[model samples]
Target: MNLFAALPEKERLIAERFDSLIQDIKPLNSKQLAFLPRDIQRLSALLTAERSSLKAGYMNNAVMLSAYTRYFMRWNLFRLTSLFAGMDTTAFDFLKDGDYCLDIGSGPLTVPIALYLARPELRGKKLNWYCMDTSQNALALGENFFLSCAARLQTEEGEPAWRIVRVKGEMGTRIKNKVSFVSCANMFNELYWDTHNPLEKEAKKYAALLLSYTVPQKAVFVVEPGIPRAARFVSLLRSALIRSGMSILAPCPHEGACPMEGKKGGKWCHFILDTESAPKNLQALSEKAGLPKDRAALSFVFASSSPAHQSSSKPAGGKTAGKSAQGASRQHIRICSDPIVLPHGKTGRYACAHWGLTLVTGHRIKDTLSGDLLYADLSAQDIQALPVDRKSGAKIVNV
Candidate 1:
């Protein structure tokens, strides 16, 4: 189920406001508009292939900043919206009426804007948002865009419930107050670019730094590109946080070591979301720039200082199923891969459980997708009867 599908009116409003904001920032002539696609392509290369050459202050360049807002920022917003929509509601329960949220590397206030659109219940909360970024220009532009969206969505007159505080710096910036939530989105890759340090060491260093900003009962969210390196980083970060006494809240059903980590052939953890519900103009712009996106893929980790809970017992789509029989063994498995076609008209998917990586195969597996939690009732005898795959050595269970 596409949770974003229900917000067509909200999506349209955001698209219209975003277009108007960009025009207001820089009114482009026909010639400039024609060259916008090329500019976007160049920026994309800097963010992907030539990322090592990118400087911390690259957003100071007007053309590059405008290109990012026009292309990358919009896509990121949609991606985050989809992520928040599919997440369990309890993950965000730490956000109360009076809480502070520190967003590190908050380029153009993407996280704030996404929260407003995806979580409507948060709109009325008297929350304080501290947006931190290296580029002052991006911070200012993001603040303007956030306010513009808020003005349109806010129905009751008086003052807006959310407050924005722009801090012009990167991670480790001195924040005076302890925050309840800390979010870092699409920024860690830039920080560790061109580094030769081991992923576990780097994850430990960064995890300690990020946790310093939060108080008790704190929550942290980190998102990165779905590429091999970034996903590996997320896996390592998950391990580091767990070692630091934090609980893994999403994407991982168990606190055990990641089975996909250090696997041969660069197997990493990541998930994909369909982009069909994205704005039409964004799709057209992507095609024009020769960068069509059928799906938005990312690797992320959500952790909390609170103890881990047994919330994965519920089935996918956030719905609870009836209780099992007295002696029936229940297992929660997190689907890690898309449906894999097997021989003889059967389907298979790689999953993660308390034991380790598992290969779940069955006749009818079309209903589940990547990043879904599959609840299975299997007894000890059922488990003992399953076969194992040779390549990955994962036990095969027919559901």
Candidate 2:
């Protein structure tokens, strides 16, 4: 039986609350953060642990972190590439009466949950969804969250919008359905660059295969970190889409070489920084991420194009080619008088506060490696059902 189906409506308010939190990237003040149930706070702490380097273990850290971090950390940085590449897929192009959609690297809400939020029009249609993810822990986090969230869907009428048929699989596998959209976000960087998972071969394999099955009305989005691999992927997808007669809806136009060239890829990327009180470790990581080491507050967008991606590859009276995209991206800003803040676990005075909190440690509380607190390394393999423990010990779950 579905666990959430048994809960009363009042018990399910977490989802709506979560949606609000993610939308504005607002952090909870000490007063607001204090209101969260202790259990949820603990959940955040456990899930927020850093353990991306540990591959041999249960990957328990990734699981809990994903379950905990309802969305990307509020202060997470954005570059031009990452911004558009990861531009919330749920927000646009969702069609009414659409038959099927495929979630490539669909970890948690990347598809189903987002579809429900972004596409109210699609609520009328029978949304048949297939979420393909490699991490069991991520899938687990997704399934449980979905179940919990479903219990709380307060509809204008009754019941929630969007019915999902989510499945756990990898991207290369053939999905025979005429996919309305295939969105793959920020995964290519990890796959081709970080893990080098031979996605190059896979891109041609499945993307082309899907295009072969569909007509011009269909679409597929290959989202990556705006690096070389991402650039290559986009270039490949563009070539593939052009070959298949599909048009570019977003990212305006490919401005330059996709930003993912050898060393330049990492340099062009940016990280969010609050220099006044950043932890030494986290600060070092930001610098390593190609951000300025000394700057206290910054937001960046990375793109790999060399202005070739602009609608005009040629410059306009020395105005430059990529300036329109640069201006367009800049004009769409996330400026808020009050930036979202989260507690750093240190009792210090900080301007921002967490709208929500997530526990994300991968190693057992007793394990020394659990001390590292990192995000972005989360996957399906790391999350587990949080069994009560003397301290939060890592639990190896069955996938």
Please give, for residues 1-399, the per-residue lDDT of candidate 1 as tens digits.
Answer: 222222447655676466667777656777878998999999999888888777778888888888899999999988887777666655576689889999999989999888887777788998999999988899999988887778778788866799999998989999878899999999889867678887778889999999898887788889998878888888889899898898877777778988776344845787877788778888998999999999888888888787643242234453211235445577677777777777787888887777777887765457667776766666666566568888777878666
Looking at candidate 2, the ten consecutive residues that score lowest on lDDT are 348-357
Please list the residue runs of candidate 2 whose C-alpha ends up more than 4 Å from where it truly belongs after superposition. 1-16, 19-94, 147-153, 174-176, 194-206, 209-216, 226-232, 254-399
Could you report the Cα RMSD, in angstroms, for every candidate shown?
Answer: 2.7, 19.0
Clashes of each: 0, 58
Q: TM-scores across all candidates?
A: 0.92, 0.46
Q: Model 1 TM-score?
A: 0.92
Tens-digit lDDT string for candidate 2 (60-157): 35433432343232112111122332333332444436567666666654445543433334445655666767665666556555554555454555
lDDT of 2 at 131: 70
